[model samples]
Target: MHLKIGEVSTIVVSSPEVAKEVLQTNDLNFADRPHQLGADIMCYGSTDIATSPYGGYWKQLRKICTIELLGATRVRSFQSIREEEVSKLITYISANTGSSINLSNKVAAMTSSITSRASFGVKYKDQDAFISLMRKLVTLAEGFIIMDLFPSQKWLHIISGMKPKLEKMHKQFDMIFENIIAEVEKTGGEVETESLLSVLLNIKDHQDLGFPLTMNNIKAVILDMFVAGSETTSAVIDWTMSEILKNPRVMIKAQEEVRKVFGSKGYSDETSLEDLKYLKAVIKETLRLHPPTPLLLPRECRETCDLKGYTIPVGTKVIVNAWAIGRDPEYWSEPEKFVPERFIDHPIDYKGFNMEYIPFGAGRRSCPGISFALPSIELCLAQLLYYYNWDLPSGGIMENIQMTEALGSSSRRASNLILVPISHNHV
Candidate 1:
């Protein structure tokens, strides 16, 4: 698991035991985030919580993120937005029930709309353009991982042209955020309800936070949260659906649970989904196999330390392969199979406490947005199960459905998830 990638000496943690050590036992030693050219350009010099250096400033930003931006209360406040967007998605599916519809595109759009509305509020004057811009930025930001490996080689960044491309997109992102900030400033915070942007603007002048919150800071945080919220949430739903479809037994059992639990209510919502244990298990299984960020954001060793027998020198990059750890045969009974039943009665959960199941990650830098993400992921799957009976398109075989991971920034299926939806009511 130890090797040299380009000029960087790296350690890849693929076992749960080593993962716990890096993420928890010696978390402080590996808490720092490595510099990425794409993140620097997109996140305003890595000032965002996800890319920021581990320190008082980053700690303060994480506090704001957990308490103000994506805390339980904040996540609860966005329920209506999620429900509304998911409803539109259900309707769209119902309308095209007999034909093949691209589930991935619809899911992505719904999540994007929800993220935008939650971040900037209902009046998004340039939503179409902004969403398009965000899509590009997320792809570019994640693309920077490879270029970052050769950080000492400055010429490679220029020769690849990714830096200039990111700079150009960053300008576009800056302008869009400026308009949104201007709108928030004119209103002097929201009159009735506060969006994430308004919340930050209202407290930007507060002196207790330790770091001055600038316009760029606000913009970077927004971009980071948006990318994490929209792209990954949709990807999980896509994978969950794909898994359920490929395994007919899971699909039937999950749909039965969803219908029995929420079918009586005519629609599924965030609150009611808590009772669908089977559906939740299915989602957990999906996350176990297809983590949103398979190789999580790289962590830099702050100081030299002895990990087991090896000397992990200072400044070495460490990557905890959550995907590999989740599928480790020592931990899972049948690592390759799509078995939701394995998690149905298990005590392990996704709260990062159980090292074997750190889907949202673990320790101080763990994703604080879990509360913000789960409701969307749960609601989308519940509604899909409760409303439709999906099938492969004509001539398509379920066993042959491609689960090939996409080559881009995320682990999305290379091809679109085109399925035929049969109305549950009609069935």
Candidate 2:
């Protein structure tokens, strides 16, 4: 559907066919992201990989991300960090067993610790504050930008206090990141394994990076990885668990698969995850039902183009609602159910090739954290299922599980998920 939001032309694609046309067929035409107030303030003036406009600079950033930061070897190197963090999580949860625990808080902490340790060499002292700042930034970035829909009306931003709000928030994040860098500098590269920050700092002054990476640029990338990686993965884990808990059948089957794979092994390893097919399907189904980012970051129309016979004029902001497409009745049978079996024989995956299942998105603008995120998710999910048998608090049943969604750019459960965990081996 096409609508005129203020002065900007907007194209909202809610179906797979239209989404395919915008994301794949005429991808180049809508490759650039619409410049908005929130991204400008939070993304270091649209300099980060996720918000950067499609061009030589963005291309170079993408290359660096794929080849250096998130390369297969680099992603593999973080397994130890993930394993350590998951172990800590198990211990933490183990301590709280028999009591109704807030799994969401624990999950967020787990993801934050792993991401911080991997990205910054060590977990910083201000980790919780940093995560809080990042969440606020995400909220601002997902906010309504008066100037975005009506570019000529820049004054509205100031009038609404959005501009000042974003600027203030940006300053807070900048200071937090500045301290992070200073701490790393003080370490003098003492760490044996280089963190992503260390690697980027090493290359920041390189003459061959096509364009010199400024300090802000490095900070932008760091913020990108930290903010994007932690929250999304945490939300996925939380939602997947919620779905499984809501459907006892799925929980039983997925737990059976997990326990069977890790029987007597005590915990799940990277190798063991490959054999947990049913658990994999459960994750996929969870993603389908609840993608972290429902309305993917909006794209800009670089040029006038036709998408499924609809003429999208130049400068129109295009938004492909991945959430809607995933649940479209035409592509999915009983689109609302938490049925993992739907993927047993289905070829749809998160690799972006399958239009119907793009939880991570599709095309040149798709998320690059797949390699970095999937292992962490699987490991955490496997360990959680393998070690504990979960039940709702105070004899709460599956039907009462709060599935209400918190409204945001990335939606999570509106309330923290509290569950009772029973240790399988009576530890």
Candidate 3:
């Protein structure tokens, strides 16, 4: 469907076939990210991977992302970090056993800490403030304000007060990054291993890439990792848990699978994560239903192209509604239901192929942090189900759990999920 919103030509793709045509068939034609006001200010000229216009520079950055930054090796190197944090979450839940606890906050903090330690080899002194700042930035970065819709109206930004808000947020963001970078530099590589920041700093100092890396580039890349890794991963895990709690049968089956696979050993680890087949299926179904970004980051057309007989002119903004496509009845049987069994032996994966299930999106601009995120998500969920039998807080019913989608570009739950935990007998 085509929409003309304040001079911006917008095209929305809500069908699997159309999504494929746009994301894969003519991937190059829509390789560039649309210039949005939030990215322009927050990402320092939109130099980050998600906002960068498609070009040789973008390609170079992507290459580094896939091979060095978020490669198999780099993701694997963070295993211990994931284990420690997830274990802490489990311990916290256990300590508060029987009383109501805020699972949403606990999970978010756990994931953010893991992302921070993996990035800087340490956690921030004011971690809570940092998380709050990230939440605000993500909401703004969705670009829903009037200023974004009418980009040509430069003076309108000031009148609406959007410019000042973004400018203030950007300074807070920079100050945080500056302090962290300075701390990392003072260490002088004294740490035994290189953090993600260290890797970027190393590459920048040596001018090791075809495209030079500026300080802004480094900061922007790190921001991308947090938004993708910490925010998205935590939200997915939260949704998966909510779904499981609402469906007792799913909860039982998932727990059995996690326990049976990691049982006797009483632990979750890289070696055992693959064996939790049903658990993996649970995650797939969750993503299918609650993709963090219902509509993925927009792509700008680089050339005129024919999309399933529709003429898409150059410069039109393209948005693939993963939420709608994932729920299309034509592609999925009982699409609205949370049935992990449907995916138990299913060949469908979310890695862009089979556009019907693109949780992380498809094609050239798909999220590159999947390798960096899935482990934390899988590990946290698997452990939560493995060690405890969860219960709704006193008098709370499964059906009443707030499954309402919160407003914003991010599809988070409107309410914090509260639950009671009971230790399980592994034997």
Candidate 4:
């Protein structure tokens, strides 16, 4: 469909066929990331995987992501961390039995802690500082900066005063990242721990791949893992909790299934996690309704490509609205409702494909953290439901739950998901 945002004429590709063309068939013609002054400065001039232009360098970085960091073997190695965190969540909920709990905040903290530990080997003792900083940066990045829309409007940064704010944020981020890098370096490179940063530092030492990994590149990668991995995973858990709470029957059934399968496990472990298939379905359904990143990061056309009858010009910014596509009436029945049963026997999965379910995106440029994210979300949701019966605080009803979307580089729950948890007898 045609869309007019201000003076620009844009086409919105809500159809799966068109989405396929832009994301897969003519994928190369649409793999570039839209340039942003703030993003460039934050990512150390597009050195990160998410913003880097498609080329040999990007390919190499993507390889490092897939084969080393987010690869199946490496992701599996973090199972212990996930299990330990989920256990902590369960314990916290149990302790707060009768009081209202902000599940979103807790989940966000859990994911961020896990990501920090896994990626940087540092877990923030006071997570709020990090979370606040990230939220601020996300807001700055998502807003419409004049520089992004009109590359020629270079003076607007000064006139609008966005330059100073952007510079301040950049400095703050650099200090945080550099501090972590320095601490890692202090470990003397012989630590038995195998965190992502340690691996990257090792590769940097070898420097056999032509371009050596600079401090800027290392910082960008660390930022990507922290921001991209943390917020989205936390948001997914929040949505899952909200949906299940809204539908108490579904919540009960899911909880029962988890408790039944894990019975005497004492804690939610990797073994028990594999058996919570119904809970997994709940997470998939949540992603369907509330894609953390409502609009997948904008992709720029690399070359001219024909879609339907129109020629998509090279360098044109293309955005795949996974949010709308996931809820398209033609694809999902009662698209707005939260229903995990929809996946009972359905083969559609989020490892891309199933255009109607492109939560993690599709094809070559799809999110590399898909494996890490799903398990983390699944385990957290399962543990929460298995151990507690949730209700809104102070006579709060499902309607009272805030469904407002937080505006940022990604979509998230506008309000912290606060609920009272009652200890489950079965567990």
Model 2 residue 136 distance off true place after TM-score fit, in angstroms: 1.9
Q: lDDT tens digits, residues 235-312, model 4?
A: 888888888888887888998898888777655567667777788788889888888777888887777777889987
- For candidate 4, give the lDDT: 0.79
Q: Total clashes, candidate 2?
A: 0
* Candidate 2 Cα deviation (angstroms), residue 143: 2.7
Error of 2 at 209 (Å): 2.2
- In model 3, how large is the Cα lDDT of residue 376? 95
Model 3, span 193-297: residue lDDT tens: 568888888889886576679999989988888899899999999999999988988999998888888887877666799988999999999999999899999
Residue range 1-427, candidate 1, lDDT tens digits: 9979877898999988998899999999999998878878889999998889999989988988888888777888888888899999998988898899999888988887888778887545777787688777666655545577787677786678778888899898888878876785787665335688878876897647866888889888888777778888988999999998889889889988888887667778887878989988998999999988888788999999999788999999998888889999999988999998898789988778888888778998887776777899999988888888888889688878889997654567777799999898823
Candidate achieving the largest lDDT? 3
TM-score of each: 0.95, 0.97, 0.97, 0.95
- How many Å off is the CA of 119 in candidate 2? 0.9
* TM-score of decoy 1: 0.95
TM-score of 3: 0.97
Report the error of model 4 at residue 8, Å: 6.1
* Model 2 lDDT per residue over 1-427, tens place: 7778889878788988878887898888888998877878887998999999999999988998999999999988988899999989999899988998989988888899888888888888898888788777766766677778778876887678888888988898889888877888899878646799888877886647778898899888988888667988898999999999988899899888888888867667777788989988999999998987899889998888777766778888888898998999998999998889999967888888888888888999999987788888999999899889998988988877989998877867888999999998825
Model 2 error, position 112 (Å): 0.7
Question: Which stretches of model 4 miss by more than 4 angstroms?
Answer: 2-9, 189-192
Ranking by lDDT: 3, 2, 1, 4
